[model samples]
Target: MPVAAFAVVAGVIGAGPVIAAVQGDPALPERTAGQLLADAAQASRSGLKPMSGTVMQTASFGLPGLPEVQGGMGGASPTALLVGSHELKVWYGGESKLRLALPGRMSETDLIVNGDQVWLWESEANKATRVKVDAGAHEKAGGHPKPEEALPTAVTPQQLAQQVLQAAEADTVVSVTNTERVADRAAYQLVLAPKDASSLVKEVKLALDGETFVPLRIQVYAKSSAEPAFEVGFTSVTFSPPAAENFTFTPPAGAKVEEKSLGTLVGEHGADRGEGADPTHGRFEDGELKGKIRTVGDGWTTVAVLPVSERDLRTPDTGGQRGQDAGAIADTILKSAKPISGAWGSGKVIQTKLVSALLTDDGRLLVGAVTPEKLAEAAGRK
Candidate 1:
């Protein structure tokens, strides 16, 4: 879903009282949740305007069972900013991608769809893949089922405000505190606790610009836990209209292209695994796990996966280019693979990385560094 706009923070119990004091009016029109949300949504719709600016985001999360293994998987700790109508630049995945002209290079995770087909560019490997937008598989894969339909012109501040409002509508509250500044504009801060204590998200604090009513920051806390599930922040914003050509793309000559029915790389990757293995059952150590490994373009393939027992999870071996520092990389991956409890209980994909994939016996596809220790821990070895 549109890459959850921002990560939220938890354990903000004292924040409400502190924010109320900063607002300078303890009794200032205690707005009901509904009234406040409506006003925010209205403000957002009215504030729609063409603009452009930069944004810098930093997000960090800990692992599922091993909190000690922190900071393992995200690209760069803090994302650099240089986005606008004509260009969008990002430093991630140990590389950089810049979109300055039509048919230019793009990051592997970058998605560009124009006309009837969607184009995915992997600048690191210098390859591009294409999938028809009207593919029926996209309907099942959570993408725009029909590209021919009229698409929203842009993601406006108003649309963001509406999302926040929808969340607020479910839980009624008596008071909200407005503080903090985003994009050099005033923002409203709200502290909310889930009505149901068992919810995955314990508490959420949102910062919405007072004038524009757009979301500036969001922090999500795991219930009964002081640690945050994830956190995201926004800055350097411009509302200028993007150029028509910004969304279009044309494959380069001699570029290797593959057709897929799914909308996202994750789905495509999963489908590949399913097709290569027996649907009834599969083993982690068997040769069924083997698959073709190639760089997006001309780079050499440098990732692999091997089976490991529970003891292997605790044992660290010195080999290959260590992903960042061991502790940091472990933390990043764990946090992204937070656990889920239910019938379908499979963990969620917090973030996708450009690396190798591991198909486990239990139907889990672990992606990223395929180190013995990393895979062991991810596969619940210990």
Candidate 2:
């Protein structure tokens, strides 16, 4: 997990139009802060009923000095939010079926999950990858896996809200503020702020549907900032269950297809299934990571040390000698990184407004929201 993700994530619209207004509605019982927390926690643990709707996500990372990063997706460059107000059509049929669509300029991409199978289809490329789901996965009784676990796409509020519930209670200030309208539905605002002053996060707020108690919107802010740097929420929604046919999919003819088992899709049988429950420290489950991930600090400014792997970074054609080229890829990334030295030793440092990273002489990637000095200190720690 990215350090800020230890805070929150999302997408959005033109900043000017989202000042949510609360219209007169039924008198829903006012919930205390404790009750609200309990309710969110319950929602996280319970099974979601069938529902379908459109969710619009928008993000703006307030990276200072990088004028190239200003434009959200759809623009030429990249922003912290990943892309512009990404609209997704979402569907859920209890626990047995699920589907989502991401509309694009030329073609829409989709994913469908039914029974013990999941399929990801890219219409533009006319390709699909199908994988069998684990029979034991459903029995675990937990919130759905992260979006990356579901598919290589955006995660729904139903899934992300559960993550907040589990992580917030331990180090955050939970409270209830005023109500707002989300997707035209009345909503109760639940705000969570990190108690640690060293945290770059200002706060995270979730908008719970007044009627169903489901989260409709989530926003993340940086410390001392007025606008949300990242946000995702429903622009419109309906609680009605979707038609059964909506959860099914048949790849278009001529499309390429690949099959994989659940373990291959999720790395249950990967190179190293280390003994830890923390997702943030994991780098090589799918094999893109060729390193040992270990945290160098605790709490807000935790620095992560990832040992670089020459094999993972090399091109497929590079073959055998790639292992000997250890820092080759790290060096490529260090082109923009500046040289720096500390008591720990000399290395390269990359600093953005929100994220700071250090590449040590020994091929270790130390990164965190803290400054380079902090990362250097962490790299030197005994």
lDDT of each: 0.39, 0.58
Give all TM-scores, in the order shown. 0.43, 0.64
Model 1 worst lDDT window (10 residues): 75-84
Question: How much lDDT does candidate 2 score?
Answer: 0.58
Error of 1 at 152 (Å): 23
For model 2, how does the per-residue alpha-carbon lDDT over 1-382 read when each residue is reduced to its tens digit?
Answer: 1112212322111001122233234345576543543454345445456788888777665333322222111222222234356678889887778898877677777778888678877776687879876677666756455422421121553344334343333445555654578898877775656565555667777787776667788887777568776787888888788998998888778999988776675553221222121122234445545555788766556788877532333322222322223233334444667888877777778865456878677667787866667777798884
Expressed as tens digits, the lDDT of each residue in 204-268 for candidate 1 is 66766565555666655654357544545455554445555556677677776776654465564
* Alpha carbon deviation, residue 98, candidate 1 (Å): 16
Against the true structure, whose lDDT is highest?
2
Candidate number achieving the greatest TM-score relative to the actual structure: 2
Q: Which stretches in model 1 have alpha-carbon errors above 4 Å?
A: 1-22, 25-32, 40-108, 135-175, 193-203, 221-229, 252-254, 263-266, 270-382
